[model samples]
Structures are given as C-alpha cells and as structure tokens.
Target: MVQNLTKRASPHNVNDRKEVLSGSCIEATASEIIQESNENMTVADAVAQMFENLGVKSAYGVSGGAMASLWGALSNSDIDVLNFRHEAGAAFAATEGYFASGNPTVVFTTAGPGITNALTGLFAARGEGAKVILLSACTSAPQRGRWAIQETSTDTLPSSGIFTTGTVFNYASTVESAAQLPQIFRKLAVGMSQPGGYVAHLTIPTAVQNMLMDETQLPEQGVSCSLVTADAQVVGNVAKLLRSGTFAIWLGFGARGAASEIRQLAEKTGAAVMCSPRGKGIFPENHPQFIGVTGLGGHGSVMTYMQEQAPVRTLVLGSRLSEPTSFWNQEMVPSEGFIHVDVDANVPGVAYPHAETIGIVSDVKAFVLQLLDILEAEEISESQLKASQPSSLPKPERSPVEAGSESLIRPEILMEAIQKVIVDGTDAVVMAECGNSFTWSTNLLRFSQANRYRVSTGVGAMGHAVTGVVGAAQARDGIAVAIVGDGAMLMNNEISTAVKYQIPAIWIVLNDARYNMCHQGMKMLGMTGADAIIPETNFEMIARGMGAKGIRVTKESEITAALETAIAANGPIIIDVLIDPDRPAPSKGRNKGLASQGVKSTSEQKPKVQASFPNI
Candidate 1:
C-alpha cells in the first residue's frame, strides 16, 4: 500500500508526474522526488508522506471539519485512520496501540474541545512510556483574537504545557507555513528514535493545512539515532558490586525488553526477583526466584523477603521505585543502597531521595548484556552465589476460593476463570483497568512473558483499559481482553468502535454497581458519608445495543463458560459478571499508605482481610 508517485502513470494524473534530476541524481531526497512529481501537493499530503516514511502505521481520532484535509490525506496514505467515539478514547487507544505495535502512533484532533478532551489520555501515554503524537488543528493566524468558531488561539488556551516542550509534551510546534514541514518532520523523526516514551504535539492551522506547497517545501524523509548504552567501566563496577554482596532484582515496565537477560542475571546471581504492577510479565512470575509484585495490590511476600533476608544492595532495573511500587517503604531499602539502571538518568534517586543510588543512563537490555559479559568473564557461576543466598525465597500467596452458593460472584473466582480460560488458554493481551479491577487482577493472575499483561499504574486513569483494548486488539491483530469495573465500562467503552472496525475486543466487567475501590478504600480508611454507589448496570445489554455480543454472569459457576464464549466470539464481546460487593480486594497496602498520610481511621472498625495461602 505504499503509494509511489514516481510510478503513477494514469492518464488523468499524467500532469502530476514529472522527473527531476539534481546533480546527476546522486543525492536527491524522497521529498524532492515527490515535489517534482506532484507540484500541487498540499501541506497535508506532505505531512502524510513524512508520517509514512517515519513508520507510523495507524492514527486514532475523532474527525472534524478543521482537520478534514489532513484526514483525507492520511486516509489516502498507508496509515490506518480509525475514527473513534470520543477524543479521549482515541488517545487512550493510540497509547495502547503504540505499546502493542512498537510504532509511534498518532492521535489526531480538531480545534478547542477536541484538543482539550484528549489531554488525560495523552498524560497517561507520557506516564506509561509510549510514543504518541497529537496532530491537531488550531485557529488560523488571521482569525486569532477574533470571534472564531471553536477558536484554538493562544488567547483561549494555555500554551505552556500543550504547545511547548515540558512535562506533557516532549516536543511541540505549530506549523505556520509549508516551509516548516521538513524541519518539523525531522524533529519528530529524531524524537521518535530516542529511548523511552515520547508524546508530541503538532498543530496545523486550517488555512495552512490546505495551502499549496512549493516544490522546494516538503517533509524530510531521513533521520536516525542510536540507543543509550552504559560505559565499560560503569558496567564493570556494577558487576563487581553484584559479586561483592547479596542483591535482589527490582523490575519495572522499562525492563520489559530485557526479559531473557533478566532471567539469566537472576539465575546467575540467585537473586529474588520482584516487579512493579506494570512489570508483571517482564520476568516469569512462576519462576522459583520470583517473590511477587511490589506496590498497590502487591504481595506481602515481597515485604517478608525484605524484612527477613534483606539483601546487601538491591539492583533496580528500569523502575523509579515510586509510591505505587514501593510506597517509599523503609523496609524495602537495602543496607548498601541501590544500583538503579534506567534509560532516564533522573529517575533513579528522585523517588527515594534519601537513599543512596548509583544511576546508569542506558537501555536496560544493553546494560544487562554488558553486566552479563563481565560476570561471565570472571567465571561467576550460579553455584558460587547460591551458598550466600537464601535457601528458600518467599513466593506470592495464592489462596483458593471455592465456587460457593453466593448469589453474586466473587472477584477471586472470576480472576481464576479468566486465568484459566483467557490468560492460560488463549494468546490474548490482558489489561486491567484502575480501581478494584486493577487490584484483583494484579493480585491474582500470573503472566510468564512480557507484553502479555498491561496496566496503567502511571496515571491510573479509570476508563483507560476499557477503551484501550480496541487499539491493542487492532494493533496486535489478536484478542485483547480488558478486566474492567462497571464504572469504567459505563464511563468509556469502545464497543461501537470495535464493531465499526470488526475488532474482536473483549471486556470482563465486574458489575458491582459502585465505584468499589473508592467504596472499600474509604471504608478501610474509616471515612464516612461518601456515596460511591451507582444504580446497577448491565454491560451485556449495552454491548449488544452497540452491535456486539454479550453475556451476563451472576454466579461464580458461570464465569468459565462466559469467558470461554467471549474468547471464541468473532466480534466485540462483553462479559458482565455481577461480582459480590462485600469482598475486599488486596489493597491493604494502599489503605495503610493513606493512613500514614494523615487520613482518618477508626480503631474499632478493622477492614476485612483477604485469605492468604501457604508459600509454595
């Protein structure tokens, strides 16, 4: 589907094609070739060509009149432009799509409300570390300060974070002329080539988008960059440090690509491995050395390991060890501080400022490879390290919950079925939405590989996974199941979008009829008079009304059959499980953190504790 202008030989478009030779045709750019072929090409077309060259395969957005030309250009290009229900949903989908596809995805919006609506999802993208570009339209220069319709001028909106390079956007620019196209494209290309997540913004005015571009003005088609790598001496020092004392591996989502090397490193050092919630699948969760996840619905075994058989120093891999992961827990700190390796140099010591940290700015995979080389060169075998390590590391507790004769299903039983039918049986990507859904899934399901389990611990947006599953399914070209609560399912579900695209995205809604996390969390903190209840909703009916399949599950025994059916369905499906409202999710740590932060708690009312199992 790559449209080559040089090869277009149709009679009607014959005038559009021309041959241009520059200095014996030795160094002519693709843009120059295109300029020679199509003299009447607009700025939109030029930008589209640049996106094609830059490896952007898809764009998600809600189309508007302002961006009509740009939309047309993208539609004509190889990039798949998906018209979503809402701008925020589109942005969320784009975020997940970027992660699933490993490509810089685009989220397009038109003026004012369109631009503002997508900000939350864009923030999520920035926090989760994904490459997403927001292509929007702004008020034309002549129309600025005037009473223009949906005027997206500086007078109307704050330009600091949205239109400038700062926390939100890695790069931002307004294309005022066709001449800026090349430089803009170059910046985008260069930015996308760098490590870690990059969220950018490019707003083109309506007038400029349709303006005829000159032959000399076209987007640049070439840009290249290299991955960050640690210095040889630094790698050697890290290896020596690891060899000198006991160290545990603390993983974050950033270390996802280094799973193989991480496994080797863990086995070689006989280190107990723990992960953040987002880092679920990066290391094999079922491995003997694996302790458990770290924060927010994290396992108690990790605390036990840190308390009882504390390592001399912890090897932090690509994680900031932020509040969500560690809650700044003092016990998790090692005796000799941490050797934190991350792509971002600033991430290491920022979370726990008091803790001594040796930060290495390099790709996790690259750093691990070099460290492995040093260990191998010194002939540091597993047998040598095993004697000093714990004879038995604590593993995550997995309590068995029977399918009791309760009218409403238990969340634990639901997760068990999902683990059996979807997580284990199929190759679907499982995502858990924020709230109790996040806690339940993080505490229950186990993944053995990277990219299989995804959760937004960064921003922890409510409706993210509910709508993002569509993008993941489409980008991955496979089944993507979203474990979401009824609140999220109702707030934002892309069943219609999935139906439009014929994507078989699935949602397992914990239909508890309330914001259960807020409900339970408030109760656990002993706060009163806060209403988190919602009128009971049937997500199955909503899904069916949206032209998708649906199944309602009211009892624990119905979960497996419902999940199996949904997984086998050819189109979008929803499984609405009416979960029990009284069961407390494994969120005691979060409640405890809230209590420490001056939240009120009653001494008489103790929160219901989840049952724990014996260590394996």
Candidate 2:
C-alpha cells in the first residue's frame, strides 16, 4: 500500500505522497519582503532566488553544516534539493540538468573538500561546452588563517585554470552591499551565455551570510548582452567558400540552438553533417547526408570519409575540434581552408595550431541566417547547388562474425531497443556512463529534436550517468534512464540517493564482471592473465538493499521484459543484465596499435612456437 505524504512533510511531494519537513518552515509576507528589500538576503535565500530565476524546477547537491542556510533557501523555494552521495555526483547532475532542459541549474557544496570533489564536473562542463553555475559555501570570514576545520584559501580557487579560455569569475566576498549581487550575477549569466562556455564559482562566507540586510538596498534583476557579430568581410568570405567548395559542417554542444538551421543549411548546400559527442542530437543521424560522429571512438566510415575524399571545405560551427576529435593528432583535417563559427573568437586554432582557419564571433543561428541571406544575394544557380552533391560512396562491408558462436548483443542493438521504445516523438533524455559505453551510445543513438543525450566528455568521469539521471529527471518531469557499466556503478553508490528522494529512474547496468577495457589492454601487452577480473556480484540485491526495485537478467531474451517492468515501477529501479565478459566491443583505430604490440611479442617468442610445432 502507498502512503499519502502531506504537503508540509515533502515540499516536493507529488502523487499524493506524505510530506515530512526535516526542519521548521519560515513564511514570508509582503511586509517581510519589503523589510528585506535593502539588505542582502542570506546565502540560502540568494541561492533559492537564483535558481528560481533560472527556471530550475529542481536541483541536486550535497548538504552539510556549511550549506545549511543555502539548503534552507532551496527547500523554501519550489525546487527540490536532492542530497547526493558524493559532491562529484551533485555537480554532474547539475550539468546533466542543463543538457536536458537548456536551463541553468545549480549544484551546492560545502567549502574545501566538497568544492574540490565538485571541480571534476566543472571541468567536464567546460570541456563539453555546458553552461553550469557551482554554488559553494566557504568557511566564515573570521576563520581565515586560523586553520579552521574545512577551511582553504579562497584565492586559490580561480588559479585552477578550469575556465582558462572561457570566462571565470567569483562572487562578491561581502554582501553588506546587496546592490552588487544583481550586477555580478548578470555578468556571470552573460559569460555563460557567450558562445564558448563559462564557469562562475560563487563562494559565500559564513559570517557575511548571517548578517541582516536593510530594506531598499537590494540589487536589481540581472540582464544578458546579445552575441557579438562578425565583420561583413568575414561573412562575404564565408559565403564565397560555401558557394564554391563542397563543404561539411561539424557541430558541437554550443550549436544546439541552430540545429534546425544547420540541418537546413546542409540540405540547401548538399553538404554532409557530423557532430561532436556533446552534439549528438543536433543532427538527425538517419538523414541521408548525415555522416555520423567524428573523432576518437567515432565510426570508421565517417573518419575515412573526412580524411580521404568527402569535402574540400570544412565548416566547424560551435565546435573547438578538441583533442579526442582530432585523435590527439594535429593532422586530422587536411582541408585547404577551415571556417570556425563560435560565440567566442579565442576558441578557434587553439587545438589545431597550423591550420589556415577563419574565426567568426557571432551567435551560431544568427550567423548562419546571415550567411543564408548572403548566399541568396549571390543568386547561385540551382544546378550549381545540385552539382555540389557528391556521388554516393560504397558502403563498407560489415565486420565478419565468427561462425557457430553465440549471437552477441552489440551496443548498437541496445540503442536500437531504446530508440524503438521511445521513438522520435518523445522528449526523452539518455545519460550514458564513461568509456566504451559513451562511444557506443554517442555513435548509435539516433538523436531527434525532442530527445537529449548527455555524457561526461570533458572530464571523462566514470559513474556520472546514474547521478546525472536524477537531476535530468527532476528538470524534465519525465522518466529518466541511465545506461551504465558495472564498473562505473560500483565506483559511485548512486542507489542510496535515488531511494532517499524516491526518484523513479531506470538504470540499465551492463554487467560484464570485469574491468573489460583495461583487461583488453593487459591482453594486448602479452599478459593473458585475468588478474583484473571482478567477481560477479548481485547488483539487483544491492539495489534492493537501498530500498528500490531490482531486476537481474542473464539472457538476451530477458532484456525487454526486465526493461518494461522496471520502467513501470513507481519508484527507482535497477536492471542488471549479465553481458558476455569475454567479448569486448571492437574499436576502429585502437586495434592497430594493440596488434603492433602483439606482433613484437610474437617475434620475441618465435623459438617457442617452432619448438612446439616440430612434428609439423
């Protein structure tokens, strides 16, 4: 039987659940609001207002004595604050919330160790081009230089260089002048809204937060500036290139707003489309001109086409073409000329040093619209546009399957199953774990306008998916799914958080019972030993211990049934599928490097082989 929670107990209570307030509630009347007008609100109140203005319905963070005031503010607001198991999980969930809804979200942490643990998500956000604000409470101002518990030098925070190229700023140290907060927050918002990315670290000292503010001194609401525009000459040059050369468009996370326009431009110009991992859902992968993802862990055909015969001009929009996309090698793009359109001018040519690149600082959608206008002014013939379409290249043969062997379920199959279930119409979000799971999901998932997918591409942090789902689900008010691996799931105990909040999330744990990727590396090093093997534990039992429903499956036929049952469950559910431990997913470019090492070992052991084959 389900117990109906009261509104007071669970302020976030939905589904007629009982409300249980962990603390006393403070009511605010019109007179109290007017009285507090001049003063800087408490850290908790300020945080609550910030999230409310950002359109965040819910937020996730770890709570402690340091952040109690902020927690009070969050609880007072309509936003539900989920207490996570780790600070990293809280930060990752905040990033995922932004990815899912395009709305700014908050991640709260206490000073010192909590802030340190949360930095990984900040780096991930910077790398993946996500806009996220991390709210952290610091030790009281009086505790400075006294070696107070959980104290650290506040000055050292900015020097971390996480937002080196992008915008990085700190909140005001004192709130005695409440008039400064709005402007400071506006600047932070503008920085985040800028094309590249931004990380605003707001630290509130305990002493300043406890002070009462005089009414009428409060700051005004914040405002953001428009995107910078490109020069006319640059637009003309881009138009000329688009008209003359066969081009392909490479998009990144920052290009989300111009997805439809990008697709239209591709269709109009007869160009092929590719995207970074963060840009997975920006382009419809099923479209004829879509060439799949490019970079490390990308499809082989897409890389071959980009390198060999596809196009002479590459238009990189909203993408920095960072390391893994360039295969950590500078010579990835052999094009004569490259055009990079980003909100930030500094992002281009940073990763690719020697390229002849043109940088345009403008909003991606507005710039593309202007370029389309320029193309129309040129009056290029329809025949000329038709001529830009290259003849279809022959599709490569599928990798050969070993005969008389068990039919192994590939990652593509898993993507297909989810795609079939959700279809293209639903507003669904997929949170994928790091490693090969990321590669497979990014490569195979067919992204639609309504569907969003998130991964920790920047920090490449493991165990991000499970916690990310909690935040994403809260933001969307829809069911969330996490596609994770057994290794990653163990690293972060996310089950506790899920049960505590009663968040109904579906976790698909691909259990292979080993550190498979590392094991593959060990095998390539002529070490056929299985020391890295992890014992198969009952993941379902683990979930049950945390007060959630759990399902275990060993055969392929059981996947669908388990998934259906898990999704229908009223609370959080974990489905642990026992995949084949021996069969690892094949990578395109990685095999050659391993094979070369294997060849050297074979040569060194040539004598043993001959001795064993003496009868032959």
Candidate 3:
C-alpha cells in the first residue's frame, strides 16, 4: 500500500544513471525506485525533518498558497512560526534575534514580491556579519516561463556570494530528494560555522511537495566542522603592536559577542572604548573607560578626544565600519597602524585605507579569547593595567529652574516617569523613532537582559520604529513601547496596524509642534528663514479613531498619571504628552550653545501657527 501511494505521487519524468545499488548496475528507472519508497514521507515531512535536524527554534514569515506546504512542515516541526505585519519586518526581527543570541535565525517568505521585500533585512544581516537563513517559496516547477501567479525565478537574487560581499564561504541550491536533504543541511551547518557568513536558498516546486522519498537510498549525515581559526603568528605580531603603543578599541554592531571581553581589554590596556550607534548598550555608559559613541548622532566629546589624544594603535573588532558609522570621513581614523578583526576577510580593508592593518578572520568571541591568552603570555602586570585606566567623567548636572509656581513638563522628567512605571518582570521591547526622541531614549533608558531596544542602524528610516514595535511585540510575546516624535507619527499610519492586531503596545508621542531638531539645526546654521514649522495634527484622536485607547496630557503633573492608566489597560494605548515644544534635549558639544539659548521665546512660538486640527 505504501509503495503504491509513493508511485502515484512520484515525479512524472526521470532520467536513469548507472548506480552502485547492491554493488551492481541494473537497468532501472529513477522515478520507479524513488516512487517505491515515497509512501512514508512527503515534501512537507522532509522539510520538517531538515529544520528539526538544524535545531531551529522558530521561523518568521507571511503565509501564502505557494508556501502552505512548507508552512505545514514548519508547523509539524519543532519550530514555531511568527506571522509579521510585513515580510521585511519579519526579517528585521530575525536580525535582532541573531544579534541578541549569536545563533543563526531563519525567515521564510512566499514567492515573488514577498521574497523581494525581505532583501533589505538580508543585506543588513550580511553587512553586520550575522548568520541568517532565508527560505523563500517559488511557483511549481511546471509554472516556469508561464507567468503563473506569484511565479519568480530564484536565480535573480544576488547570489549569497554577492550579498556577503564575496565573504561567503559556502552556498547551496535546492535539494532534489530526501537523500539529498541531509547533505544540504550539513552544508548549511558548515557555512554558518565558518568565520564569515553563509546563505542557503531552497526552492520547492508545488507539484513535488507531496512526493515521498526513497528511505533505502537515504544519504548519511555529513561531517561536523569547526570555524577556521586565525593564524597564531599573525596574532602574535598584532599582540606585539598592542604592547608597544597606546591603543583604543572601537566596538561596532558586529562586536556584540565580545562585549565583556572588550570591556576587560580596555580596562587592562588603559585604552578608551567607543561604540557605534548600533553598538550602544553593549557596555555600560557609566564605565570609567567609556568614551561614548562616535558618528553623526554621537557625542562631540568623543570626536574631540579621538582627534586630540590620537592613539597609536586601534583594535577594531567585528565591524565593517560602514560609511554612516565612519562619518563618511576616512581621515577621522588615523592611518598609522590598526588591527581589524572580523569574521569576513573582505570587510577589513575595503571601507578605509589603513597603512598597516592585520585582518584576523575568526569568530568575535573566539578571537577575543585567544588574544587574551597572548596578552597573558606577555606578562602584562595587573597593577600596570589598573594604573593605565582612564578616570571616569563626572555626570553633567541637570539645569535648575527659577522659583516660580508655573511649571512645564521637562523631557528628562517625562523619561523618568515612563521608566519608573515599566514593571521589572515585564519583558519589554523599546523602539525609538529617529530625531530627538531617540536622543532622549538612548541616553535615559537602561535595558536589562529581558529587554531589547531597536532602531534602524543604517537607513535611519522614520516609520520603522512604529512598525517595528508591532512586529517585535509579536515576536517576543511581550509588551512593546514606541517612543516617537509627532513628526514621525504623522509620516506613517502605524495606528492602523496596531488596531488590526489589537496589540497592547504603548505609543508615547512626544508632541512637539515643530520639527524641533531641524528647526534647531537651521537656527544654528543661521538659516532661520528656512521652512521648519509644521502644523501638527491631533495624534490622540487618530489613535481613538483606530480603536485604541488615547490619552492626552497637557500638564507636567498629568504625565505620570496618564502613563499609569495606559500601562494598566489591555489593548493598544497612545499617550500624547504635550511637551513644551521649545524645550531642547541635552546636546553634545557642537550643539550645546544653541540648546542653551532656550526655545525661541514663548512670544515667538512660530506665530501661533493655525491649522484645521489642534496639535497634539
């Protein structure tokens, strides 16, 4: 009965080849033999088994007819599926998971456009040196060249090779049978275990999904492998340079794994530690050796420190050092000598031209551990290490207010209230929209192990924060809070998605009437006449219309009460805090003068701009 069922579901056409079956070649049809063993398994079963062997915990993607069978397989397997608002959002969540845990994450999308939508996140993972597996379903094999619904050729995507910028050590195509599945999975494991990166794109035909496999012809499990280690001689030479010169360590998103070790190394070497925006929260900002972040949105003091006390050596670990993080200025980084450690060899010398750079291609954690060994061998004294540590900078004092009964809600006070209300055990995920809102969140919020904070690192997309909050809440099964500016809230209709899912995400709208950041920038540049004033809309009403709880707070005292009420409720909630539109957030050295000047006097509040609706 099993053999008959297998025969009926077998592929219609097959080509025969000489094979060592029972140590002899016989005249046999591949289709017949394959069909004979098809009764026990289906395409869905095979895919499930493959994922099981891979030890995948969960997968995220949208569902469609083309991917139904694969989804069924995943459902049957140990992996849980997370449906997302957008395919790209699903991919982004996967990327975040990879960052939090150094494990490769999987994302599956349906055919054609769905697959294309996931490309951005894939590119992000590749650039950040993350191991990610993207599985996309395609139309049935019979639909090739026929313009079937959602039909797309899988070959069009930049080969996993191109995506990795030529650093991918392994790549594989679709598996032909159950026997081939083990080999494909083995290759995937090896690729992920490699120092740099890996991608395996599996395409399945709708017609063959129900076909069974030949158990007798199953292939043996492939070999387990370890990551390629860096050359010891090269490591020793780099160690010598470190010992002889003053050095600084710059941590990027890729160096996430080595956070503790990086901190230790800086403490031991008296080297300063600076991180890129994505690398924020890796180390405690209050640490004595910390020098703050560097780049466009970073502290100006960091730039000053780097320029004045130019370190003779720089130890760059696990960073591609992209244009945005590098400030689009190669001259900012000294050209003298540096050791660039990355999983991918191609990333070390491409972005910046360094005079003497030794590329150590290995896992960030592994490389740091080995380097520690070498440092110990050099007999670096503990007392000397302690003596080299930089003194901690004192925290800046908060600005004092005059003795007046009248009060206004300060940004810092609002942040403190929100932070205080967030319960300790609640697994929270925070998303900060671009602009001063992010500036406030990055500086104020301290994420514990159970929490994660997200932002668009490269593109700096505005609407991503709101959408990301929804997706993240879905992924983590926890409360999500989105801190966004009124400007960003207007750019996207996020309330719609929140309402549709009935997700209990808290939306905190920093309702400043104008594009405050841009306005401040223009005023500082003496372009005061530039159009910076924007008529704000009623965000609370919009939330209410979308079937969410909307509360508006105009007074400073009402902020905490409003937040308490929102946090206690169940579904989506929006708290529009009517902040003093003129207040400026804490600024770096470059913008300190402008911020200190205070908001254009209340009398000069942009001429009381009139619009159809009340702002905030």
Candidate 4:
C-alpha cells in the first residue's frame, strides 16, 4: 500500500507537504515496505546519508554511469571514495578497512560484470567474517530481461556465492523503490551493529537512483550488539573438564580482547596455549605456555606436545579449527574430549565429531572473565610449566648460505631481516597472502600485539594481501608490509592503487618464479612442478612503472639494506627478493596425507633444500 509518509498535509506545515509531495505520496510494495517521516532530497543523497548513519565513513569501488548518481552524491558528502583499477581490488581494500578499523566499509560497482568481478573479494569477506557493504547499481525494472545493455535480473536476489543462507549474512535484498530505502537502511544499521562480520548487497536501479526521497525517513540507529556470557550449564561443564585433567587453551582472532583473562585461566589450569595463524600475538606466542601455531608453517612443538603431553581435555576458544590452521588431521583433534567456545553456536562442535564436545556460545572476553571468576572460587594452581615456542619447538636449521655474493637468500633469513625492521605494534602491520607467503610468515615472523599480523586463512585468496594493504595502510596509521608470492602480486592491481593513493605499503615479493605451493603439493602427490613454473619476471620494473620505489635482493647481504630502504620509502615500494624455491617450508611433512594418495607419475623430483651457490 502507498502509505502517507507524514500526517495529512497541514495548513502551516509547509515542509511536510514539500517533503512527501515532491513525487506521488510515498509508495511501497509487499516485498519492500517503509513508514517514517519525510524530507526533500534525492534518493542518491539518502543512500549516501545511510552510509554515515551506520558509522561507515569510507568506501572503495570503480566508476560507471549506472552508479554515477551514487558517485556524485558521495562526492558531495564527507565519505571518502577510493577509486581502483579493478572491482576485486576495491572490494578487498574495503574488507581490509573493516578489519583495521572495526567499522564496515562499502564497495560500489556497476551492474553485470562489475558486480560479478567483485564476487571473489565478497566471497573472501564472507569467508573471513569481515563486515563490508557491497553497493551495486542494477538494471531498471523496465530494462529487466529486455537485453538492455549490461542488464541482468538482479530483482530476484539469487542465492549463490555471497547471497546464500548458511553463511555470515542473514539478509540480502535490492531497493525496489525509494520508499523501501528507510527499511533497507534499518537492516543496514542492524547488520553493521551486530557481532560477527556481515556482507550486505544493496543494488539500486538506475531509475530509482534518480528518484526523490527523504534522509529524515531513516530509522534511529539501533542499540549496540550484545552477546551474553556462556550459560551456567555450559560454563560449569567447561570448568569441570578444565579442572579435571590436563587441558590446553586454543585461541583465535575472536579471543583478541581477553588476553589477560585468558592468560590467567591458562596459568590457573596448568594449560598450554596454541593459536590459529590469524590469532598470533593475541596471546604472546613467545610465552612458554604457547607451544606453537596450530597449522600451516605451525611448529612441530604442537605434534610433540600432543604426542607427548596428551592433554586429557582441550578448550578451543573462538576458532573454526580449519584445515589450513589444523591440517584437518585426526591428530590435531583431541583424543579425550573438547570444549569449544564461539560467538556462533553452530561452530563449536562442528570441527571435531570424534571427540566428546561441550559447545559454549558467548563473547570470548565475557566467557574468559566469568570463567576466571569461577576457577578462582574453586582454587586452581598455576600451570606446572611455561613453555615458549622457540624453546619447545625451535625452527629447523636452514641450509647454509655460502660466503658468496651470488647465493640466493633463504626465506627464514629474509623473514628475520624483515622482523628486525619492525616495531611490533608501531612501525608496520604485516599482511601475509596465501600459499607460500602464508606458510613462511606464519612460521617465521613473530608478533607482540594483536592486529599486528593478518592472514586470509579463511578466504585463502592469493592476491588479497597485496591490494588489501592499500586500505590497511590508510586505515591503520602505519605502514602495511604485504608478504606476497610472485604468483599473487601479478594477479591484482596492487601497484596501481598504492601509487594512486601514495600509500606507505611495502610489498615483499618472494620471486620464486613458480606457484611453489602447487609445485610442492604436486611433488608430494608424486607429480612434477613443470606446469607450476613461470619465467621469472622483473617485478622491480613493474613497481617503477607505476611510479613507486622498487628494489631486488638476490643475496643474504642485500636483504637487510633492501628491507630498510623499502620501509623508509615515502610511497609504496616493492622488494622483489629471490628465494630458493626448493628450500621447502619447514612444515613440509604436514602434507603427508596428500603423499599417501600419491599417483604413479612418470617423473618425480625430490624437493631441494641442500645449500649450494647456483650460478645465475
């Protein structure tokens, strides 16, 4: 029904009639309904205001005519719009913005290919639970199915990719009319306010973008999102298991704010600590109780501890226990029992079915604090030992870099050089891309604070770190060091956006001339690495082409100086470092499962980690 937006046009309330009568009385359909006050403003202006109302101050996307109205309106407002070379890069950058600032950002794109091009990052955002607003321009209703240029039926709001029901987002819809915007904005407020990341796609038709609307019609911003502590039964159950036997505490990104309470609980219960890769530094990894990182280039200390100590109970806090982090191994899952705490109720018991599990749904911080109180009332002693990762699980020895100027730099030595150049929480933030970059960074570098380290283990997208660094550099008020592989840097528009914005992002490209992860994984499967190989390209030239500083490091002696130079640059820089491809990551044997299923291939070459100078 077309409801009256304001009380009947009165004798003296001139603004009321001027607000609702600019067009016909406010109209809404069954699918899209809105009822609120009125004002005199264009639909574009109202949408722009919706952004500010939801605490989002920045957005990233490409430009096209279909979204020109939104572009113009945003240009007139305080919102910062960052234009990028590709929609995927823009979307990834916005995802980083949310990660860095805790405020969801926007990704604006035109219809059809523009929208489809953004799906990769959107999928990444959903996978990682990063809050992002995907605002796209759609075809007008009249243009639907008429084969209009760049037109598709977005009206139905199909359920695929990020639009499905089972993921992080619970709502997805397009603006059917200008009147529907108030309710749409209400949903936006709710999504942004809630816990866990949310990705909402609001597609506006070109015709509707030009329609008139009212900013005052938007509902009042809702209450802050709140999650209860674990219910008494679940909390008591977890406490009982924790007190009864040898238990280890597992942490993740969700356990970020409760570091002190978590540490206290671990000490009281005599538990060791292990974390997901993204959860590094949330609990001091250097602490003794922190046995090692769980998956990827994770420490062998985990295997040693599990096989040796064999904790009778494991308390998992705010982690999915994903394949990349835990290798999805039977060994990683506890043999005795499990206690899993997560904000989402469904995630607690999902990863380990073989173990007796207690699932607790609550805020990580709240749960830890209350659990500490309970443990205190029951009198528990400090853990018998505090074990550091390096002491318990030292890094494997590297092949000696001969005393020659021509030898390629070892990956661990490169990481140490980068580590020396960092200030932990101040000077730079490390964003590691997927594949070998992830393994090396997670296994080699150590962080001292939360958010200082970031990896897309959930999304595991190759090119994410390079482009996402642009937004991180901008939002974090510090330099962003993107540890990326040769294969990933070439896949996105990292150099273009970084140069355009003059961001202080350093790309440490491990120029191995191959998708080394695939190369190594295939070898483990008894296949050759030939198809994974690519001719080594001079990435220094690529950076210089984009008006950014560039450097190439081939030897150990050059790494320290190169990192120092790149980190000191006034704008974006790329340090293309030659790493020995065959210096297989220390966690090489973690993939034995793949080795078990190896097929009989014609040619199989053993990985090369032995040190020798190769004449280039």
Instruction: Give each model a TM-score.
Output: 0.92, 0.84, 0.74, 0.86
* Tens digits of lDDT, candidate 1, 32-142: 655544676778877777787788988999989888888877876667888899999999999999988899999999999999999999999999999999999999999
**lDDT (Cα, tens digit) per residue for candidate 4, span 1-616:** 0011112432112343454555677654422223322344567767877787787867889989888987776665556777888999988888888888887788999877888889888888988888888888888888887877787474433546434334534566777677787778877777777777788888788898878764436555754767657776668767776666567788888787778888777666557888898898887777766777877767666766776666777888889887767655566666677788888877876777766787888888899887877767766444323222112433322335444445877787888788888644245788989888888888778776777888997878777998898888866655888999999988895687777777788899999999888887666445443588988989999989889889988888898888878766778899999998987765632533223234222235333221110000
lDDT of each: 0.84, 0.65, 0.62, 0.74
Q: In candidate 3, how many Å is residue 338 off?
A: 2.2
Residue 165 lDDT (model 3): 32
The backbone clash count of each candidate, in order, is: 0, 19, 0, 5
Off by over 4 Å in 3: 1-40, 100-103, 128-130, 154-180, 195-200, 216-225, 328-335, 386-413, 416-429, 434-437, 443-452, 470-480, 485-507, 511-553, 561-616
Candidate 1 residue runs with Cα over 4 Å from true position = 1-36, 217-220, 588-616
Between the candidate structures 3 and 4, which one is better when assessed by lDDT? 4
Q: What's the residue-level lDDT of 214 in candidate 3?
A: 53
Sorting all predicted structures by lDDT, with the top scorer first, yields 1, 4, 2, 3
Q: Whose lDDT is greatest here?
A: 1
- Between prediction 2 and prediction 4, the one with superior TM-score is 4
Candidate 3 lDDT tens digits, 485-535? 888777653455556556567889888777776776555444547776778
lDDT of 2 at 65: 80
